[model samples]
Target: MSFASHHNASEKGEFDKPSRKKPMFPVNDRLRAYLKHHGREVKLPVAYRDLQRFTYSVPLKDKDGKDSLWETVVYDLKEWEFIREGLVKIYAILKTEGDLTFTKHLDVARIDYCAFGNSQPFRIRIVNKFNDNYDHYYIKIADASRVYGLELEHILSPNRITFLTHQQTLVEEHIPGIPGDIFIKTYLQDKETNRIRLAKEFVKFNERCFVRLLGDMRSYNFVVDITPDIEDFQYRIRAIDFDQQSYEGRKNLYLPQFFKENYPLVALTLEYLNKDSIEQYQTEERTMMAFRLASARYRMKELLDIMGKDNISTPEKIGQLSKELSDYHLKNPGLLRCHSMGQLVKQHLKVCLRKNLLLIPRLQSRFED
Candidate 1:
């Protein structure tokens, strides 16, 4: 936790963009086994390679006619027949746990391919036949680093993620929220928007990402989930993209407040929150993460054990991040000794949350009472 305070002096930290497109690391036998144990491993009718058979694609555009970085893919008649049915089933698996009872009326409306990011995900739009309603889910080539990021988010954060893997194919339910960049652009300045609550959420969100070693939370990488509560509203910042989790060499890359794209949110935090209030929010987030860790300690231990033994990052990047973290924590020799990214993640978790973990009561209680 001592090291987390260093960037507070500047109110923003500037760092280079991601060094390169991260190579997809295979989900090893151990990770697969863990997924099976947790029921994340399932047999899917389609694989990542199957979707690449599209005949052609048309560039997608937003309402303002701007490039959306996605292309609507068109498949051959036969391929489309196979893919459409399987996709409908995959949607069922994601939303209803493999139940085919309701999939009879469901159909694949469209498939959009995005070549902009690491995973190169295919976004599937599933529509119900009875009405015009539609929903989306993603299919990606499962990278171990991204899987680790998703699992950590599911366990350590206030939100739960639903995803499944079959060999190299990963299916993820679409997380619903206003993209952070959109929210910041359109909603942040609304008179009805709550600046103080948004600022608090950003602070907490920043803490969560750094403590867990997730990175690259630029405004567009996450979403702002606004919920109506009491007489006002509640804001929750959630990381929707996890491609950079635990892979970057730079320590500051893990903190959202440092990214220039997030400067406006950082300015809001600075304007609405004093130093003490910032500390209080950070502490509160860490405490909540501590409780989540406590509740899932055994499962987390298993995941980290598999991760620590795996090679998800290059030795150079691992060493670079390790040394940076070691220096940040007063040159603690333990961080320097960490040989893997997983080791660094585990160590960082302990270092940042040690005090809160100590203070956590043995008997957890619900807030309802």
Candidate 2:
């Protein structure tokens, strides 16, 4: 299947205020209390400062001729809720409405340091100008979000993602960490050793994501956190982007199938640079890694069937797509090489086995009247 096309546009003017439809979830007080009490309870000892009620007097108007203003209360968290536990910021949008969106001025790795990197966060606002209609209003807003999400996801590591809110023009949590591209390009140098390690992790992560039916793994939607002083750049990864994550059955967007049929080939090509017969060092543990990757693919298929029954593409289409994807990989051997022909066959067999195993359970589970 062809990848969808994307368009990037210049950033828009600053929002004067949020729209009325975008009320700060009335749970504001309770959320803060939870953060206050639970923030200290968590292993991560970062402080959560409530910045709500802070006047964000951007120019905002409403459907009514009456004047309305956008207001926001934000919070800054000094570290990740997950790994690395370094300096980070999470802003809670107290309120917003109309065309509210955000754009990044820096890559994920340098996001936390945007202030230091001479990059300013870009804000896009939809105005209630008499000239624009409702349809035009939404079109501008959605296009802006798409560009922001895709571009941002590109700069993040495999496991890192960013959080955003349009209701209050919120760009929550500027995470401080390494970009995924940098990690892939620099740290994952020993072709076979790191390739297999990364593949296993990718499979596992994709499986979990598919089970939940999350859609669209954009390249730059995440950020990686490295230990303050690493001996050799060893660091844990956490996924940050959740904007595209949700239980949308209508799309049949399973995590596993997408990777196997779409992502793996491209991802492997990018990671391995089409290296041939690279040594699988002791650290590689090829067989075990392969198993994990296969398992992830299997889990993904099962998850998809569970989440997307009526919405899934026809069996014929699914088979056609799988074959097409496999053929695509084989045709571009130089760009998508497996260690050897034998290894390629073995890997594909594993994928098939995993896919079948997942399908059997799903079919049986559903057929059981």
Clashes of each: 0, 34
Local accuracy of candidate 2 as per-residue lDDT tens digits, 1-369: 111110011023211111112111121332223223422112221212222212233333445654433321222334222211211212112122111242111111211111111112322222223443211000012122222232223221233233332222233333455555545555555542345445444444443433332344433333445544333333443444433433122222433224222343235533543223122221132333334434344433332222222212234433433443356445433213332222222333334334333444444353222
Best by lDDT: 1
lDDT per residue for candidate 1 within 1-369, as digits (tens), equals 332343463545434467567899999999999999999999999998999999999999999999999999999998888898899888888888989999988989989999998999999999889997999999999999999999999999999999999999998989899998998899999999999999899989999999999999999999998899999999988899988889998898888877777878887887888888999999999999999998998899999999999999999999999999999889988789999999999989988888888776762342211
Error of 1 at 31 (Å): 0.3
TM-scores for all candidates: the values are 0.94, 0.30
TM-score of 1: 0.94
* TM match of model 2 to true structure: 0.30
